[model samples]
Target: MKYKNPVISGFHPDPSICKVGENFFLVTSSFEYFPGIPIFQSKNLVNWEQIGHVLTREAQLPLKREHSFIPSQGIFAPTIRYHKGRFYVITTNITIRKTFYVWAEHPEGPWSDPIFIDGFRGYDPSLFFDDNDKVYITGASFPGAGPEGIFQAELDIDSGKMISESQFVWEGTGGSSPEGPHLYKINDWYYLLVAEGGTEYGHMVTIARSRKPYGPFESNPHNPILSNRSTKLPIQATGHADLIQASDGTWWAVFLGFRPVKSTKVHHLGRETNLAAVEWSEEGWPVIGENGRAKVEHDAKLLLVNEPTPWLERDDFNCESLATVWNFYRNPLESSWSLTEQQGFLTLYGQSCTLNDLESPTFVGRRQQHFNCEVSTLMEFSPTEEGEEAGLTVFMNENYHYDIAKMIQKGQTIILFRCRVGSLWKVVKEILYDEPSVVLKIKATDTSFTFSYATPTGEEKVIGSGETSLLSTQIAGGFTGLYFGLYATGNGKCSTAPAHFDYFQYVPGQE
Candidate 1:
């Protein structure tokens, strides 16, 4: 069976997986976005559905501006593992420099509060349950900790304590930033897999093995078992992988990779989850993809499905709560947004904090899943105050974003198109409008994004457009990608009026 590379698409990075019975559960890193660590389930390797998020509450995942908030500074790499009957997810909160784990009976859960791992100081943690019922925690060593490598310690899962001193296991094959380590015990050998080369164009996955869980391990003769660096493949930056064995005794790998715009190394859709078949060598080493390279299309012999699970392209706000795809900028105040306040519409009260601020604002968004797609929203908002505004935005963090909104400028209602690139901020276009309701749209292409607006009467007009490269990771300098956001802000003062969104739609275009 042939399937696409990115089994799970868009801004979902640091892919990790764990199998229980016949079901597979996966997780990916969510940085600076509320409801962090999205959990997904799959029956077939090519098809996956988001069951829920591990960090759904503010208590479980606190993302606040006061903690020196920055883009790509909250949740890092996460590894999901199933032990006995309970599911465990361990990750790092880089903002607080803390490593913690949470557990639940089921993947879609009432997960327990974080059990902080004392004496463990690193990122990308993984849990290994040996045949003797003993649990071990392995993770990348903290930077400047003498030598960089993978560390391991005996863990008391109940108390989150390290029973033994942490020890360095394998230092990889000398690639930079040896992180995202996963340990597996296969046939009397403990194999250590880690991603190296800094997760950019040079990203790669390498492995080693030892008789014991801790050191005296030897690197794979074919080190960097998986990578796409310097290749012309559509999928690039391939690494940070997790391996799972199927019911048929076949091994597979789920990893993170990105699809750059044609002829350019710029990708704004972010690192996505990719699947590849794995086979063991005669020497008991694993070989991934086609000679360590991921493809845009690949083959798998598992029980194939007719089609992958479909995503909802249009949200009408008819449900009692926001869909699982929606995410806030940070820890959003409960009072700032509501679905029941104005039945059949998502109502967002304009908060004093604007999108430009590092603080939490009344903003809700989803990842940009396609290179060429259309995103639009029908919003009803009448701004009486000068700073009050509500509309659609293609956001790439505080300093890099493009906005098409209706605001009160110089005592007159106007439709504004603005761009913020680093230190440069400019109002590219604006038009006088007295309408209280309007539709704001953004049409994205491989190279640019076109902003337009339509009045209630249904006449659409092009406001302006901006270069898509402006929001690329190469220029923005962040681990996150672009987000299609619906935001309401007051710049500095709270607005008495509220914005109501009738519907939000994202339609992907054929390549």
Candidate 2:
């Protein structure tokens, strides 16, 4: 028990929650991460456990190619719901534009392939079912000439088609940008809650209500039913919420929020999930936290998963599939990655001219959830000639990265730790690699990182160490977490130079 802010941590943005009996299921926008849209199961709305991912099969989504980096254009906000005996999820992949639907008899799904919702724009999509068995789907629109707010439309659940014309319900309060819509029926009114004011400093939650599913819904007299600032609190980015009811009949909201170490920067942890208690006033508007802005005591009874998950960095690469810790930067080709065939090693097939090039798209990485942790990998690479390189790196977007790599330059085997900080790639240090196989380790502590390397049978040596303070959100602005992964880039002339990773692990309190 003893739950505080962020029951779920690290890049878990735009949360959508649904209640099935006494259990609660939550999902979030996965962006370019592979096995998109992680589905989590919780009981008390606090501690959560990752049950599985909805977009596990590549055929579930239509990608531009077999292997590609979507670059901020993958799965966006997703809404999950249960109707009759089937569970349905409606969502959008910004790259795909069309809204899509998938369902299963059980939440842990053998989910049917996606059924595209013909026409829609903007990312966040929510599904609502009325007591009469009628269905409605709502979503936010990407910028265009039309009204920029949340839109709702009736849907035929069996066919995943919008029946009625979709329309905006509210223009949103001044200074707030409406997005991330969640619908619910409370008492005699239909409540529509959305995240507005962007996803940063001004982020907030707003609500509107109407007697019918689609209508001239009136704004809540006290809009922004729940937000960190409504309580004048310190947590930032208090938007993108999903609401559910507790077994005790108490209403609760689980939304994404972050507490930055400083106002100007964000640690690579991305957004952390926060919890709040909601209550309907006598007049019937929801009140958040304690008395409006009062600080509430930590509730221990809300813990969802009792067992703890072993940290990702500690995993021994001895599994058939990538660990829950690993996520591809974008959609991956199933043919390139393997764990079981390699026996004790995780093999990554080399692809692409550069990391951004779409063809050879295969990078297996893990989110940098902790600011200070150690990540290391053991691997080997065969460089056909100069310009071929494979190694382990701390990657932050396309513009920033640092790596400890092994390459054959002019037929001489060498190990180099280099960085592409800001604009240029600088070779910070270099050492002779007598063998093609080597081990690379990175220690990140308080924003500074150090790189070390070792021959397959030689002693380890510190190759390079530098300040990684710029690897923060303020410097490398994005709505994502820092990642560490195995990488290979060349002129695309080599047959195959695979990196065999004994394992990739993260350990805290290590030098």
Candidate 3:
């Protein structure tokens, strides 16, 4: 079977995988987005469906705080494991510097509240269940918190207590930020796999092994088992991998990597989940991908020939609840958005919060899965106040974003196109338009994003365009990717006006 890379695409990063019987469950970091740690299930390695999120409630993930929450500072990396008929997801909340694990009977949960692992520091925590029924937690040690390396400790799964003292294990093959550690008890050795080089262009996966769980381990002769560091491959930043063995006794690795736009090292869609074949060497060490590089496509013996699950592109907002694809910035106010306010339309009440605010604004969006895509929405908004605006935004973070909105400027209804890059903010275009409703569209290519608006009579006019590099991780300096968001904001004061979106259509262009 031939399959493409990024089995799971867009904003989904730091992939961790576990197998139960013939079903494979995987999870990825959701950083700052609500309902964190998206979980997916796959019968075969390539075809995956999102079962649900691990943190669906505010109690499990309190991303919003009294102090301003920085973007890309919430859930770091999550490792999902199945033990004794129960599923566990262990991860870190960097905002509060807490490492916790939640358990559920099924992948689609009713997950338990977080059981905080006190005295455990750092992130990317993974659980290893030994043949003797002992459980171990391995994670990357936080910088400046003693010896910098991978650490291990015996953990009581019931109470989330550390049964043994934290032991400094193997430091990776001399790479910066040796994180995303996963331990596997294979044959007679405890294999430790960790990602290094700081999750960027230099990112890599390295391995070490020891006879015992707590190591004094030896590094692999072929240290970086998987990486694309210096390569010209479309999929860059390859690392943060988790290995899983199939029912047919074949091994596979699920990792996080990003596709830069054309020749530039700017990826606006974020680090995506990719899969590669794994094989054991004659020396009993594991090898990944092709010569330590993940390719754009793979030919593997898959157990099932399932077609890739199609994404729901057009949302009419007639459902009782929002689709799982939609996400909020953080903990959203329930009253700020509604589906029943206007039947068959998604209505967003204008809040005092704006896109630039660290707080959660009246925003809902889906990930930009493809580089070449078209997103269009029909919105009915009458902004009486000067600051009240409602429209579409290609949002990367609070610091970097491009917006095209309808608002009232000096008592005249106008369409505004604005761009914000760091401290520099500019109004790219503004046009006077006295209309009750309008169609907003954004066409994205590898290099640029074009914005346009259409009147009720169906005449569309291009407003402005912004370079895709402006909202890229390299320029924005965030762990997140761009989101095609539908938003309503009142700048500083709450507005009584509401913005109702009749429908949202997202169509991906041919590669």
TM-score of each: 0.98, 0.91, 0.98
Q: Where is the poorest 10-residue window by lDDT in model 3?
A: 63-72
Pairing residues by index, what is the TM-score of model 2? 0.91
Deviation of model 2 at 403, angstroms: 2.0
Checking candidate 3 for backbone clashes, the offending pairs are none
* Model 2: per-residue Cα lDDT over 1-511, one tens digit each: 4556676766788888888888888888776677788889877776678888888777776545342233456687888898888878888876666679899888778889998887665568889999998888888876882688888888898888778888877777754668888889989899888888888867888888889887688887787666656333556778787778887777778788765654344565677677777778888888666543313235544445355555444666787776665787666766566787568988766665455454435677877665578888778676776677778878776656777888767877789988876667688887877676787999887558899987767888999986655666656666676788887665464426666778777786631
The alpha-carbon lDDT assigned to residue 266 of candidate 2 equals 53
Off-target runs (Cα >4 Å) in candidate 2 are 65-71, 229-234, 290-297, 301-307, 310-313, 358-360, 456-459, 466-469, 509-511
lDDT of 3 by residue, 330-420 (tens): 8888999999989999999878988998888899998999999999999999988878899999999888999999998788889989999
Clash totals, every prediction: 0, 5, 0
Candidate closer to the true structure by TM-score (higher is better), 2 or 3:
3
Q: How many backbone clashes are present in model 2? A: 5
